[model samples]
Target chain A: MENFEPVIVAFCCHYCAYTAADMAGTQRLTYPSNVKIIRVPCSCKVDALHLVKAFEKGADGVYVAGCLKGDCHFNNGNDRAASRVAYVKKYLEELGIESERLAMFRMSAGMGFQFAQTAKDMTEKIRELGPSPINVAKAQLKGEAA
Target chain B: MITAERKPLEEIIACVAPFRKVLLVGCNECVTVCAAGGRKEVGLLASGLHMALLQQGKSVEIREHTLERQCDPEYVEELNSLIDGADAVLSMACGCGVQTIAGRYKDKPVFPAVNTKFMGASERQGVWAERCQGCGNCLLGQTGGICPIARCAKRLMNGPCGGSTKGSCEIDPDTDCAWQLIWDRLKALGLTENYVEMIPAKDWRTSIGNGPRKIIREDLAE
Candidate 1:
């Protein structure tokens, strides 16, 4: 487990988090490479299906990075995304998975440092949790097949 | 519309635990409107079930489908092809929908994913309140369009009872007293006379008190 490198998927809102990620790159801020960012028009555009699908597809950790509260390019998208994240967290708990595997983060377009920090923090958290159970199961199945 | 809520995940997981393949059916009618069973919910449940089962060291195949109306025989026929592949069926609809699927496919074991609550109207976004009991009769005319049989805690024929206080039912402060609402509506429409007129004791034959009832419209019958 100590050598495990977790896979984290970040759904970044195009108007803010995605731009912030670009800014981090330009500023030479170093974040973990484990975090893969999927740009969405708005955080609200990230549906529950997408979040669950992430885990189903072997993502060890998932997060939605949107604009700060009340700062959504489309008003309340971030808030909506937060509630959806909360909903899926309870669902993950029901599935016998750690709810902490999923999260919702808020930041503005100017927060390049925040973006980099969020990625680093999320990566560290998932690394401690180790690989997702779904991924572990898939590995076992593969081993059996081989 | 009919309202329902999903059963606990533990119960559902247990039901499908023995099966390797499951056919998850969702209704696009009442269950969809109540947000209990629909395309989106089917996807969420399917994914959740898949991961949950995998965690148990068992892999299950869950095929998802939503019908226009599960209670209709023609719509349920849509699952004919998929039904053959699944070992069991998980229905995410009201009880009627579950029974419809169970009746259509006798060989496959059918299980309900949700508990049918009641005939209701959406009070607001995400909140629904019971509105009718399907008494097989409509009494909205004399009750000022409010149903005492369904809304009144006692199902009193003439009520407000001693339990009415501050426009709310004594049973629960949050619940509005049906009689109070009836009085207010009657007063507003200048039909207060209807309130004082003695309403005869209701006949229970038309309701569930007797037995299951069915209606056949002769004109529409084939």
Candidate 2:
């Protein structure tokens, strides 16, 4: 597992987290490239299906970044997204995948440092958890085939 | 409508463990309203099963479908072409929907993914409570639109049954006493006279006490 490089999918809300990520870019803040940002109109738009599909499609970790509390442009989209993340986390546990691999973070439109820091923290967490079980199984299957 | 909840992941995994290809069927009827077996649930369960099976080193091909109404023969017929490719069928509908698919395709192994809870009404968003028991004879008119058979724990016709305390049933404080609700409704409508009108003993034959029941209409019959 020494060479393991985790692939993290970060679902960023368009009005807040996405803009924060842009701020991180302009500020020259460097976060792990392991995290790939998928901009969504609102975190509420990120369905449970999308979270599970990320793991299904080989994401080692996934996290949703939305507006700060009460700052959602749609008024409670972040709250909805937070609950959805909690729900999907429970499902992940039921699937035998570690729930820590999924998370929800809140940030305002100007928190560029917060965005970069979150990406770094999540990457570290997933790195510590190693590759997700699905990836390990796929690798095992591939190894057997080879 | 009939309400249901999905069976545990362990139970579902065990049922489809031997199959390589599974047809995960969902219904758009009661189960959907109950948030149990709808298109959204089908996607969640399918993805869950995939990861769970994959973790055990078993990759499964799960084809997901949500029928317009699984209990109807016409809606179940839509799976006719897709059935050939699947080794087994996993229905996320109530028992009626499961049986519909099972009855239509005698050759395929059909399994239920949800436990049919009861015929109930949604109390609110994400909350459902049993409201009816399908007792052949309904006494709602006499009880001021409340059913004693289904709501009362003891099914008492004339009751507040010393078990009722502060408008809640003795069995659970959270459960509202059916008789108490009936009295309140009757009093509000100024029909308190119905409360003392001695209800006769109910005939058990009208219920499922005798056997399975069915209704036939001559005009509707071909």
Candidate 3:
């Protein structure tokens, strides 16, 4: 029995991921609605603070969707996003949070099907991993016993 | 820029033991620029400390605070109320800021969260290279902006040491030979004449020697 319906945050870059999502909607590609999308100008603009804050806010998983490498509307934005993602993953492991809680994906604007697949895959992965510890801790604080 | 790196979370956690109420101090200057002891690092360090303590079944009140510049007394004073309830303070600044905390709060135990490396600059993102020895001398004009004292494996003043091989330092092949870097930089800038100038032995007297160093600018003081 699936117990946890994971709340996942998908940070979609306005340049690509957001456009890709629009395409997915137009294409009527079915993806899990568990993922909530936040639009940012560039993936490089996403900082470590944003990733940690999402988890603190009870996101079971966080994913950053940026343009394909070298195709960032803002030059090098995807590269910078890649670095931030890697750094935050290490940081999450260090913070006693499973680093897999954070993930990054690269796709062109035309890859609406791929975007849907990514969302579906990430939601399933989080389901397998179970609720994030931060969320569990919050629930306990709210007088709920695990 | 001063060279610095984050202390392993294990080491930092070990230092904070036996204290329940603790203040985590992050510096906004060198440590921040180095990504070792900045505000963001303060959060990361605080979270790690909290997780470590929780895992051990120990309750710790880890308070996070960052100063504009920990080395300055004014910034240290800003932490007065934030540290009032804490049993101990963990400083994520360089050695200078650590001493400042100790000097300011004589009653509390102040610990360091980063190893003060050397005076250096960021070679690239996530890469810091030691550039200055704090020898109380500036010799950038002579070295073509490549600091031999810090870059050279041997700190050779004149030229590349015999240990240099194929433009790489013998100590580590991945590291560019310091003299080679200097020569390339000078050639690029058409300043090879600067390399001909002899650099004298670093004088120990002018640096952190003869006791704790102090810089008092009477004009600026007013």
Query: Can you write out model 2's per-residue Cα lDDT over B129-197, one digit (the tens) per residue?
Result: 999999899899999999998999999999989999999999999999999999999999999999999
Per-candidate DockQ vs. reference: 0.84, 0.87, 0.26
lDDT of 2 by residue, A1-146 (tens): 89988999999999999999999999999999999999999999999999999999999999999999999999999999999999899999998999999999999989999999999999999999999999998889899889
Compose the digit string of candidate 3's lDDT tens values, residues A1-146.
Answer: 25689999999999888889999999999899899999999888888888877886679999999999789898898998888899889877876789987999998888899999999999999999999887666555555333
Order of all candidates by TM-score, from best down to worst? Answer: 2, 1, 3
lDDT of 1 by residue, B142-201 (tens): 989999999999998788899899999999999999999999999999999998888898
Residue A112 in candidate 2, Cα distance off native in Å: 1.4
**DockQ (model 2, Cα):** 0.87
lDDT of 3 by residue, B1-222 (tens): 876788877788888888989999998998988888999988877766665565465668989999999999988999888877999999999999999999999999999999999887777877887778866776767888877877888888898888888999999999989899899999999988987878777776777666777789998995
Worst 10 residues of 2 chain B by lDDT: B213-222
Residue-level lDDT for B156 in candidate 3: 88
Chain B TM-score against the true chain B, candidate 1: 0.98
Residue B78 of model 1, lDDT score: 97
What TM value does the first chain of each candidate achieve?
A: 0.96, 0.98, 0.95
Worst lDDT run of 10 residues, candidate 3 chain B, spans B50-59
Ranking by DockQ: 2, 1, 3
